[model samples]
Each structure stands twice: as structure tokens, then as C-alpha cells.
Target: MTDLKRVDIYDTTLRDGAQSEDVQFSVEDKLRICRKLDALGVDYIEGGWPGANPKDDAFFARARKELNLSHSRLSAFGSTRRAAARVEEDVVVRGLLSAEVGVITIFGKSWDLHVTQALGISLAQNLELIHDTIRYLKKRVDRVFYDAEHFFDGFAANPDYARQTLEAARDAGADALILCDTNGGSLPSQVGAAVAGLRDLNAVLGIHTHNDSELAVANALAAVEAGCAHVQGTLNGLGERCGNANLISVLPNLILKMGRETSVGEERLPKLSALSRFVNELANRPTQKNQPFVGSSAFAHKGGIHVSAVLKDSRTYEHIRPEQVGNKQRVLVSDQSGRSNLLYKFSELGIELDPKDPRIQTLLEEVKSLELHGYQFDGAEGSLELRARRALGQVPTYFERRGFRVIDERRIREDEDDDRFMGAEGTVKILIGGVMEHIVAEGAGPVDALHNALTLVLSRHYPSLGEIELADYKVRILMGSGSMSGGADAIVRVLIEWNDGERRWGTVGVSDHIIAASYDAMVEALEYKLFLDKVRPV
Candidate 1:
């Protein structure tokens, strides 16, 4: 085997990723992500465009004092001086300098269409801009990277002018010449061919791609195979339009698949999944379950035969061990699960049972029946564990529910142009240790009211029940074969996530009435908490 080529990982999530729709990073958000990127061992972290906005300006101002990065060098991104402007006096150039960063990446128009139509400048004038901007920045910063914006389209439009543009940057002491698929319309073949054509250049070559064609990662790999040494992308593929290349996906493919080395060495690779979720949490976005390598479902196995084989040898279905990237193997239990699936899931939940135990078969059949009725246990392992323990006669009854009532009220305000206000209240009666406890509470919705009432009654006996906060609530309506014709009485499935400071678990319930389903899920979540704590029935 040949020695792996070392590639530089340049992250632009703070700048380009923040441009995604509904994504706006505060100065604090940018600073927090910078520290994460540094710990992940990325070669460079591209801070946002200084002076472009108040948030970015504040971030750079604060970063100079606060960010004591150990591995990554911070970079400031901007564009060339405007047409008919002096490089020294240009406001954008000055903004880049005021950032006080070691590296500066500046993009210039490479497409003839943009130069003539967008900027309305002569071809010779465009070349001069690329040369002068790069030269001026190189003299000031430790390194200057020239991003050839729309280079693929530019090359297809006028190859001679495109080469002249790159030559201008190369001759002006630019450290790296990055080819950008700005429009994200180029095929992998086109990107590889373009990079292969530029192999004769003296400066280091780089690849920056977008996902308009859903080929951002593919195009990046293509460029690397064609001799590019630097790869630029966002962390979760977050950016404008379809988004930029996903470094999370690209990094694993480079190291594990292509045998390439990156600054994210073997030791840091295990933290990849946490880093991916950290960004998603800060962005207030749910992690994409199917995202390659670092996603929750990246290594999850569901099929019965697939699970049966993977139990013996994970290589039968898994491409790489999930632990290599900090993800774990998950065996999902559904209607299609076999004996092996149940055994695997039981072991995962720490429920030990012999392979010949008849209760295992009974639990499997019960799971199949429940799944047929719309109770999905794959995402609600806490509920599944409770069911398994109950079947084994290990779980004791904690409390008996006497009854509950929920009342929803709506009022129309006449002076407010018929605005309707809604409120809900719930009353719960439970028998705990032969003592009847009655509780009442009001909440924004029926489920919330019931949860409040139930917890108020239970917390007196089990104080930790009050500490289990509801982290997430998801409701899915099952239609077609299960319910009434018009969907009025369709079966609703409620999945509730609960967290108690350290651990989180999910429980599922299904019923025709939404309130009933929510109650079942809430009760199960509390029961699971008690089960984990080994709380004895009072």
C-alpha cells in the first residue's frame, strides 16, 4: 500500500453555514463553534466576514482576546477590492486586516459572465483585481488563499481567461488557489478534470463545493483524487441553498475509505459524532439520523436477517465499526424482528434471558402485535425495556390509576376582533399505598395539563419524578387502515422524551384518543425513571 497523502481540513461553518435559511449565528455562537473546531483538529477555521455585519464584527473583536486555539488557525473571509479602487484604501481589504487573523481567504470572480455582466469590467481588469488583492493580503497576513469563485463554469466558458485568472493569483504569492463550485452545478467528472488540468500550477490546490447537485461531498473527493491537497466545507453541510460540502462525511471517507490523512488524526476521529450533534444542538436543528458516519442511524440495523448476521460479525452489514466515529450499533425491534433481534435488544437493555426462554418468544409476539397496532418501540427503548421487565415478572406495580379528567375551554373575545383563547385543565386521582391523592393543574394543552396533574400527585411519593423534565414530545397520526374514514378518530402515537440531568430515554403510546396516548406515554416515562432508580412501591 502507498503512503496516504495529508489533506488540510478547512472549516467554513461559521461563515457559509450561517447563511443557511433560518440560521443566524450570534457572536457568541460563532465563538463557541470556533473552540469546537479547534478541538476537532481542523487545520483552519474560517471566521465570518469581519465588518460585514455587527455580529461577525463583534465575534472577531472578541475572538482575538478569548479564543486561545491550540490546533487550528483562524481565517477571515472576504472578497477582492471593488472595481476602480485602490487595494490599500479598500474598505473590504481593511476589514480583512482588522480581523487580526493569521490566514485570509478572499474570493474573486472567475466566470466571464460574472466579470462582464455582474461586475461589468474588462477581462484584463478582472485579472488585475485577483493579482492585486492576493498580493496585498499576502504581504499582510501569514497566508493568503484565493478562492476562484465559479471556476468550473468559468473554465467551461473561457479556459484561457480562467487560467490567466489563476496565474494572476499564483504569481502574486497566494499560498493556495481554491477552485469553487459556487453554483454547485458541476458533475464530479468536471471537477476532477478541471483539477487534473491545473496540476502544473506551483501553488497548493484546494476544493470548495456546494450541494446544488447533491454532489458536494462527491465533488470534493473527486478533486482530492485529482491532486488537490486542501478541502473546504461546512461541518454539517450547512450553508446557503442546498448547502456546502459536509466535512463530517468527507473526513471519514477520506481517512477510512480513501486512506488519506487529515489533521483530524485517529485520536480525534472518535469525537466526530459528538461534534456533529454539538453543532446541530447550537443551531436548534434535529440531527439528521441518516447522515453518513456521524448520524444517529448511520450504524443502526433493523432487518431481522441483517441483525442475525451482524450479531455474529458486524462486517456482514456495517462498512466500518460505529465506534470509530463515536456512534454505536443499534438493533431496532419491530414487527419484522426475529428471535435474534429480541435477544440483541434485550442484551442492549441489560435484560438477560436464556435463548430457550419461552418468555422471549412471548415478548417477541407481543412486540409484533403492538407494532401492528402502531406502537413503534425502536425509538422508544425505555418503553420496550419496561415491557420486557414486566413480562419477566421483575417490575412491581408502582401506583394504581383511579381516574382522570381533562377539560378544554375556548373563549372568543369580541373587542379583539374575534380572537380565540384556549386553555386546558386536568384532574387526577391515584391510589398510592392505599392513600388516594387528588391533584389538579392547568396547562397550555390537554397533554401538558395531564402531565402536570400526574406529576404533582406522584412527586409527593417519588420526589425524583418531579426532576424528570420532558425533553421532547412528538405525535404522529396513523391513517388509512387503522381508523375512521375522515381521520377524526385516527390512532395517534405519542413519543415522549424525558431527561433527568444525566440520562435521557423515550417512551411510546398509541390510542385513538390523543389524551389517552399522551397519558400512557407520560406514565411510562415516569415508570421508567422509577425502574431505573429501583424505587420500591410505597
Candidate 2:
């Protein structure tokens, strides 16, 4: 703890993260993410490489007017002066200045491989670029950071030259010298030792790591322990190649696990999960359910022994309190669940069932039977609750499905083209209040049509369904046992996520027919929504 200092959280999700495949952020997206990072209390936000593209340039132009940043300084990122260009004549340098940002960050080659092979420049000239780039930007910008790219590799190749490159930046009046594991190949020990070698310099030190080795968080923390005060990362580790260090994971590890102080206040750690999910939603990426601190399953306990122990003392199988990071303890029910797990599941469903209740054992056996048919209850608590209530003979049927029909048509246009187009329609009949209600709808597919028709019929009785929205739909095909001789009759598992503004829940269904599976999951999703509205008050 002696090396502990006030840790600065620097987010590069806008710059480096934009390089990730499928991560395409608009100008508005960048501004929104910057605002979120500010609320999270980060000290710096890399807005992007200002001159690299029209989009980044437009972002900076808008950010100058729109970004009233409170906790973080907006930074424009770019490389050092080119091998042949003067610092005064560099296009990127001009872009950085025109960005009107609070900070300027430029990366220069630290590894000899990059200096000699990549840039094809003499070692002396490369050192000059690092120094001149920082010295020139330091005048216009409030703070200038020198990212020593491939620093560990350089230090490993030639320690003296590596130290000289960093010394050149420090001497040229750089505000901070950030050591970057740019290739992300360095181990934590190597990063620590290399960063420790430069700790005595009279400049703020920082570390930026990528997750190619699956050790970006480790390396970043390792650097922190070695006296570096600033760490650069992205939310949910979004970046090129593998990804950057995940601040969502790193901040919790530092503040909660290692007792280190960071700008992300302990009181604000609860927002971590929301922040992570929001970023994922904006990036058009599904949230990783198993991500360390902020994912849905981060604190989910599924094992029987684990649940029993957690019921006694949550610390038994848990590392830290789930609520500490805006997450919750999930007691997942499945064929593997024990009595303690069953009790926890009942509690979640607002049902009271004794652990010794004979119905509990019978329900457990039923879950096992259902799982044998490819039903996985771990993520489908809504469906699990429906099954549990039916086993106890307490299920109050809200609607009885009398009949359903689906029609799919594919047509080949005559004069237009050879493209094939499809249309689907569904008809549903349900008995509610002892009266038959029939509805019809059309959609892009059979499942969508079925869902539309059911909603048309159900919302009349349960108008709260208007608040429900389909957040996600996942389908996994069950192989082996259930599949036909050539995998024709494979059972499909459908997991549907529904959010009702206030909360989100998942429902699961399994059937040999994909449409049937989807319909079952959709039914349970709506039922769970109503159950919550009736039992859990706003």
C-alpha cells in the first residue's frame, strides 16, 4: 500500500475503442460516452485522433461546444512527428491544437524494432521526435502526455535506450510519461519491473495496457502497485485486437479489492454495472454476462454447495459483495440446484416454500427432467418460477391458449429481380375471463407474428404489457442426444430477455420446433412481466 497514490482513471474508449470491430460511434455517441465517463469521475477522456478522419474531426468540433466536462480533461490523441516532418509542420500536431481540447497525448516508438524497422529512422532522430513533439504541444495544451509505445519491448531489447527515450520526453517538458504495452504481449511482472525502473522521474507516470495476453488488468494494477498514478483503459475493455484494460474491472479491483484510492469514488461504485451496460448498448454489442464486476452473472451462484454456503455466509464463495458494484447476488435454479438454491429461487419469485416441503423435491425432479429435454434454468428464472408454481399446484392460469396458426410465404418477383421475399402471418385464440379472444398479425417471421398476435390479445387484459420491450433474443441448438440421425430434429433453446423500464428478466424455453420454443419463451416473458407488476410495487 505504500506505493498507493491518488489514482487517475483515463478512458480511451473513444479513441482506441472505436477501433474495435463493430464499434462504430457517431458524433453524438462520442459526446454521450464522454459525459458518462465524466459522471464516473475519470480524470481524462481520449476523444479520438482528431485529424485521422472526418468523423473524429467533427467530434472535436462539436465537443468544443457541447462538452462541459467536470471531472475529466478531454484529450486529443495522435502519433509523434513523422520521421521526415518537423514538429512545426506536422498535420496531426496542428489537428491536436485545433481540437481545442484540454490535453494532448502523442505516442512515439520506444521499441528499437519500431524505430529502426517500422519508422526506418535512426535511433537519434526518433528520440528527437519524442522530445520535440511533447515540447511543442506543452505550450498550447495544459497537459501533454507522452505514450512510450512498445515500451516494455524496448526496455527488454535495450534498457538504456528505452530509458533515454522516456528521459527525452520528460526533459522536453511532457506533463506525463505513459508507458504503453502497445502490442499487449508483456506480462505483469515485466510491466512492473519496467515501470519501476522509471518511478523516480519528476513527472506523473501512467500505464496503458491491451489484453492480448489476457493480463491487461493485471499489468495495469501491477504498474499501479509500482507507483504509477494514472492508468489508461476503456469501459468493458473495448479496443483493437483483443482490447484495452477494462476500467470497470480495474477500478473495482483497485478500490474494493486492493484498498487503493481512485477518482471513481467508493460511493459511486454502484453505478459501475449501469455504466458498463450503457456503453455496451451504445456500441451495439451484447453485454458479456460473465464480465468480472459488472456482468449479470458476475455474482450468480449455481452450485448446490455454493448456494448452501452462501445462504449461511455470502463470503463463503463470493469474493466481494455484489452490491458493491451495482450488481446483485443471483441464486440460479437448475437441475443442479440444492434445497438452499430452491429456497432462494422461491424468494426471488415472491413465493414461500419450505425447504422440507415435499413439493420442493418433486419440483427439483421436474427441473431435472426438463433439463434432460434441453431446458437450462440458470439464465431463465422466469420460466423456472412458472414450473415451480405448477409443481406446487398454485399456478393461477391467466389465459388459456385454445389454438394458433402461422402462415409463411416466399415469393420470387417476376420483372423486378431474382431476390426472394417472405411474409408471415399468425392467428392466436386465447380464453380469458371465460370468453374467447382471437387476434391476427403479420411480421418478418413466424415468431414475430405470433408474438404480435399474442400481445394484441393479452394487453387488453394486462395493459401493463405496454411497458415491456424485447431487449434480446438468443437461440442455441441442442446437439447429440436430441438431434436426429443427421441432426435434423435438434432441440432449440430460446432465451428471451424482456425489460419493463424498471427491470429486465430472462425466460427460457426448449422444443424440437424452433417456433414452439420461441412462443414458449415469449409466453413466460409476458407472464413474468405481469407477475412482477402484481407482486412487486413500483
Candidate 3:
């Protein structure tokens, strides 16, 4: 039997991770995320550099009192003292010591290039900075980890000197020696070889990688297989450049693929994607659709053959089950979809549509025809359900729009003496449910006016339906057609969101015309809420 050892996962999402470009989290945000990470069962949480910035300092000071982290030991991170100062006298060291945390992590220059260029110090002085700092911190805390910044490149350049630095930290009683890919350009093969070389060292070995080369997770795993017992990373891969290793991706791979156990609870694996999106939303950054196990499209299927095969056995198309990492399989509807795909989707939604039913065939043909005209229902579940209900003659009683018009005008007054100039008024008309709910609203643009007019009419009947917010909107123009075609065919997809009392869910719509696409998605968003109300009877 292969002896599976347990590994420690240290999360630095609040420190090195917050350095990600444009990722600035307030102290309150940091505390909230830390609490979530603690509940998720990470072994260690590196709060921040308390001495470097007020925000980080405030987080550590406040988090210690308010947040009760049960499974995680809150760690304070910083650099070793300057070459000339003693460890106890340095401001950085003093700040860490004052934080009253049980664990402290300090980084020092291991690469000769950083010593020569960045620090302007001799290699011996740099070694002293690492050794003396660790020795001093050991006196104050039970655990002290030394992050060897740029260790791999340093080893490649000066094997003897780099090994000497690790020896110094080990001798000084540093608990762990973490090899950092500070530049994020190291390959997996190189990482494996380097960790293998350090296997015989007395100290515990760890890895800290970045994603500049898009290989942070791969490199960290390679280090683990090569014998490193600990992994350091940030939640959702947040970090300085590119990002730090994604603990979200790394944890499951360790547990499921490598047979290694972690302090993290098994149930928390499924919440990874939701937690990732929650952090991204709080940070005001767009989540990547293709991000490894936890992204929305990670297990989504669209092609006919793939979907059919997946229905037979998900392993045919999926590397790992979606539920293993808190995600679900999505069967997308597109021009490439087959009858089996539609039937499967309908069944999953609990809509009993028999394959032999004439109405089912009609709906299938209508969907395919609409797809050819640039309507994509794959991302629009609510819209597809609404279409299915309408085809089956089961739509709810909705008010009819007899006619509607939108007029957008903008006027600018220059110098008070000259007459104001007026922008052209844009207008649109539509009829809904045989009712004449005529609305003439003005806006800065035509699209705005049209959206306002529709909302004005729909709000009357669905008074409880909250505001429809656009989460994501994408536009793609296909230009391969011949010059004779007046304009390139356009495809617009929009994700609309609605908030109930408890939570919010998004629905999508796609169309050839931009306005129609937005409108279709908006209607679907409202319809989904309506359907949920009936099903759950809220």
C-alpha cells in the first residue's frame, strides 16, 4: 500500500495575493475572507504584512479580536531585517512580533541577482539576514517559515551559494524552507528536480509558485510529487503578478489524485467555485470562465456527441466529477445540439416533454431555426424554459403590451446666449399580450430608452420582481461573409441577474440584435423568478 502522508496548506490570499493587479481589498473585506477561509478548514492563514501598510496592520489588529479561526493558525508575514540592523531592532520584525500571532513567516533574498541588484548587498550579508532573522523569530514563536524568494533561479545560477542559504535557515531552526517561484517562470520538470535535490535536507520542504507562465498549479504539484510536504498559495490564485498558486485547484488534486489527506474538510471541496466567485465579486473583478475545476464552464457540454456520451458515462468527457469540486454539469443548447440533448435538458429541468409528442418536435425545430438566426439558448436556461412552457400552452398570465414608444433626447446649453442644441430623438414601438401600455420615456441613448420603457410596463404586473441587473454582456461579430452582405452578422449574449430575499441567480439570453438580446435575457430573468415562486410557493 502506498503510504499517503498529510500535507499542510498555508493560505496567503490576504498578503502576497492582495498584490494582484487592481486587487485591493479593504480591511473589512480581508476579515470576511479570512473568516470564510478559516471555516473552509485551511491549516494556516497569512494575514498580511502588518508593518508595511496600515490596511494590513489594521486587519491583523482587528482580526485577532473578532475572527475566531478554529482550524487555522493566523500567520503574520514580512521580510527579514535590513543587512545592518539586528532582527529584534528592525521595524518589520518588531511589527510581526507585536501582532501576537503564534506563527511568523519571513522572506529573504536567495537569488544572487536580487542580492546584487535589488538589495545592493554581498551574498554573505544576505545569508546573515536570513539566518539571524530566523534565529531571532524562533526565540519568540514556535513556528517560523523561511520563504526563499527566487530559490530555483538562484540555485540554477549558483548552486553552492543557494544550498548554503537553505543550510543557514535550517541551522537557525526555521521550521520549513519554502522555494518561491517569485518570477513565476519555472517549469514543472525544473521544480521536480530542485525539490528532489532538497529531499535529504533536515527541514520540512514547501513550495510557493506564481502563475506568470500559467503553470503555478502544475509547478506546485510537481514539487509535491518530488517530496515537498507543504504547499503555500492563495485562494482563487490571487497574488502579485499573474497570481500565486491556486489552493482551490491544488487541494482536491492532492486529496483525490495523489491520495494525500489535508486538514481541510472534504465537504468544503464543493464550495470552491462559489467561494471563488464570491471573492471575485467582492474584489470587483471578472471571474475566468475556463478557470480549472471551479469555473462555470469547467464541465459544460455543447456538442451533440459529447453530450450523448456524457449522458451514458460522465467519465467519457469529464476529467473529474463536477460535484467533487462543488460544480455541476451544464448541457448547452446550440446549433450543434441533437434531439437527445434537448430531451436530456428538459428532463433535468423537470419538464415532462415526451420525445414522441408533436409539440416537442415543434419546439425543437423552432429552437434550431432561432439558433440559425443568432439565438443561443445554451446560457439562457430561464429563456429556454419559458419557450418550452409557451410551446406547451402553460405560460402564466402576463399583461399584454398594446404599443410602446421610447424617445431619447439630449440638449446642451452653451454660453447661455446661444440657443440650446438638441440631439435627435430615438423611438421604438412594441406590442405585448394584446394590451396597449403606451410608454414614452426619454434617455441619453436609444438602448436606455427602450430598456426603460419595457421595465415600466413589466413592473406593473410583477410588482415583486426586483430590478434586473446585467452581470455580463458579450458581443461577437462574424465577418467571414462576402462583401455583398450589408453588415457582419452579430451575436450578443447577456447574463441577467435577479435578487430574491435570500440570494441571487443569473440567467442568460442570446440574439442577433443587441437590443433584442438584452430584452430577451431580461424577460427570462423575471420569468425564472416567477417560476421559482410557483415551484417553491414563496
Which pairs of residues collide in model 2?
none
- What TM-score goes with each of the models? 0.65, 0.65, 0.64
Give the true-structure RMSD of model 2.
8.0
TM-score between model 1 and native = 0.65
Query: Mind giving the per-residue lDDT tens digits that candidate 2 earns over 178-292?
Result: 9999889999888888778787776788899999999999999999988888899999999999999999999998898778788787877876876786677567666788999
lDDT of 3 by residue, 1-538 (tens): 1122878899999888898888887776677678678868888899998888888888888877777778889999989899878777998899999888989999988889999999999999988999999999999998999999999999899978888889889999998899999999999999999999987776788899999999999999999998888899998899997899999899989888888878885767765765786677556566688888988688889898998999789999999988777677878874233465577657746799768888987898998777655455543456777888888977765543333334434466555654454433323343445555565555445545655566665566555554554433434343222343466665555544445644345555555555566556655666666666663211
Q: How large is the C-alpha RMSD of every model relative to the true structure?
A: 8.0, 8.0, 8.4
lDDT (10s digit) by residue, model 1, range 486-508: 55567777877677876667788
Of 1 and 2, which scores higher on lDDT? 1
Off by over 4 Å in 2: 1-4, 334-538
Instruction: For each of the candidates, give the backbone clash count.
Output: 0, 0, 6
